[model samples]
Target: MIASWRPGREIRYHTSLNEALANPAPLVLALDGGVFPFRGALERLLSEVQKPGVSLAYSSYETDSGTVEALPFNGDITERFPFGPLRAYLSERLIPTGAERFRFAWEYHARLALEEQGLFPSAIPEPLYFHAPDLLPRPDLREYLDSRQCQSGPDLAESFAYLRYPPEADAEFREAFYAMLRRRGAFLEDLEPERTFPPGKGENEVMASVLIPVRNRESFIAQAIESALSQDFEDYEVIVVDNASEDRTRDVVRGFRDPRLRLIENPPGSIAFALNAGLRAARGKYILQLDSDDAYTPETVSRMVSFMEENLGCGLAISYYQLTDENMNPLPDGVVKHLEYDRNNILRCEGAGAVRCWRKEVLLEIGGFDEEFGNYGEDYDAVLKVSERYEVCRVHKVLYFYRRHQGSQDAVQSKAERLNAKTRIRLRALERRKKLVQNRGNKRNTEGA
Candidate 1:
């Protein structure tokens, strides 16, 4: 029995539970016009519950989507509500102000109480409301809430406690609370860290091989290895091609001692030469080229592999990356944003080049790197060649960190060397484009004659 009623000016409520189940709307389904795609919310609610229990629901609505499900309420209301200090004050102070305020305050309190009681259902699994796209909070409601003062000491404590303590200390408090609950056997198994990687067997075919070409990256090499090994995606090997580093780079690689780490020695030379060596020895269906100083997010490989799998037509998948300083500190937001927007343009200007994860077969067919322009712009050259024949995708997530340090080749290289490398890259691009045009012209001439 779904019925929609408009209360006074801006408030509208659609109640369905009471009418549907005269016995007890085990699930109280509420809807407001502000929520969009209200139908999807209804469908999700119906799908989540196979068995019966008392369910109290509320939703945050968008202007376009009808309602976004808020926390589900099923268990003890008291424990879930007023469970937190901020909520307690809201219940104690805000509710007493007026009936109009009480309705809004009660809704907020009810949601919190439901969560604390372990009655809050996952809004993701079952959306009970849809929000309209352009939905905005009423100005009157906003003004009313803002005008109310938080009462005395309790209010001050709740507001300032978070600011006073460091996040780690707050985390410790939360951990202790959860630990206590765990001892009482109330902890959910899903809350535990999930192990996605399986133990290595005798001869498991590696799914991907990560080739990291390094020179004197002794400081961050370990971090790079750790990031790669810590990936959620297993079945991958890290091939560190050492370009004759005079530093303790060997010591750093040796310390890890993971079977998945394969150390290849490349005498002090070009980035292209070292990468080509790694490519020759790589034994994976897919290949990822990483810089020794760069670190990857745990989900980087997983996301790349998934993207590649889904998009069979694409030969390479490249993601936007963040630029970090020597110590791996991220650059300013404006700088990062600009770099991301310019990545495609940068790749195009250098020819058919882009940063990407490539199929090993496609890479091998391209005859590996040109070894001529060894260090500075070799990656650009290889990517240009690959992109000529294969479809390349640009994933707009910062999955990799391009670390900038004084010792980096980009910094140490002379202006002449940099200009030379850029020239080499442009020349290579022009050559490839010329060849393509000639082939097309030849074919057209033959067909016309």
Candidate 2:
């Protein structure tokens, strides 16, 4: 009879491979014999695979257990005895076999299968079976004890070579053998569905709308979404506009099914156009324009909303942002200056630099964004236009985290594009001021003369 299984306790039982095959709930295999021996290793391995979607598990072992004994499980014997039993339980299963001798067999079979089939199951670091030293066959005493004295030199040299130089020193050696096996076609099984979102009913009322325009960013998209959803501001909506991404960007966005998230597709347009699309659809009193690669702090939206509510005169408000690499580590001593946004300061310094949040009505009243500039300078242009009419405020805390990665528009855009766009807008505004000045000069001359 099988041992009773408890929720938090470990139970030990012996079963033939056939029995294990028939009962297919996830199993953790332990190797009780190898170079390393410990229960902690198995515990750690279990902890790693205990994540929602992963299966196939393992544990560490050492081969020098003080005694030898028979394989614990007994069952019906047939012509295909051990092989049939092994195949029944582990056949087509992508398991990480941990024995020294069996490692070669696993690697060889896995690689061959992968190369032939172009599909394989993952052999992750979980322990599903334990191989005890007592289970190993004893060396034949009668035929092997006296006949090995023929060549001590070559065998000694080979052993020394193996001891000194590990598997990596040989080019023909397989390093990621399991990976090779999975690639070939050894075990092409479907993984159980993994839950990506937190459990619970979602909030219905929208508090804030986060607009993100994505192009070809497939890697950083998920991280950005997680950061947004993780915000302390619960009543928020995330609007993602796909600007014709040729990568897995669509798939990544579709994976998130939060009630707060709404995905919109924009046909091959500029960043400004995509933002405008999201802006049109946004239902929040305030709109937060977050880059697809950037992330906000846990209290970003909440703090901004609270600050805006408390300070009624401020039409737009923004906090400082930390510049980080793709790995989310801060750049060395790299700090971006926070711009002061008083009326006098605005006149002297053009407009607020970098980041800013605005009232949705104010943003819309300023004609949303100048789509002519198309990309880089559009945010600055919109801020400049809005700042001319309303009070812009800068919060002193760092709430936004901007990622500096390759392929970012700021890194790749030409100086000419920025200069041309900025100069055109500035010149146009200057000409209007000049026309006003000329008209006033004419009026003063007529009145004085």
* Whole-model lDDT per candidate: 0.54, 0.54
User: Which regions of candidate 2 fall more than 4 Å away from where they truly are?
Assistant: 1-205, 340-355, 431-449
TM-score of every model versus the real structure = 0.51, 0.50
Question: Which candidate should be chosen as best, given TM-score against the real structure?
Answer: 1
Per-residue lDDT of candidate 2, residues 1-449 (tens digit): 11111224543333333333234434433221211212343344445345433332222221233222212111111011111000111222334332123322333343333323333222222322222323334454212212332111111111111122244422222333333323422211222211121222234435578888889889888888888888887777889999999999989999998988888988999999999999999887778878888888888888887777666666678788888998889888655554534432232233364346767777887788789977876776776565555556777778878899887887788654554565566545434434544565687799999
What's the distance in Å from true for residue 272, model 1? 1.4
RMSD of each: 22.4, 27.0
Least well predicted 10-residue stretch by lDDT in candidate 2: 77-86
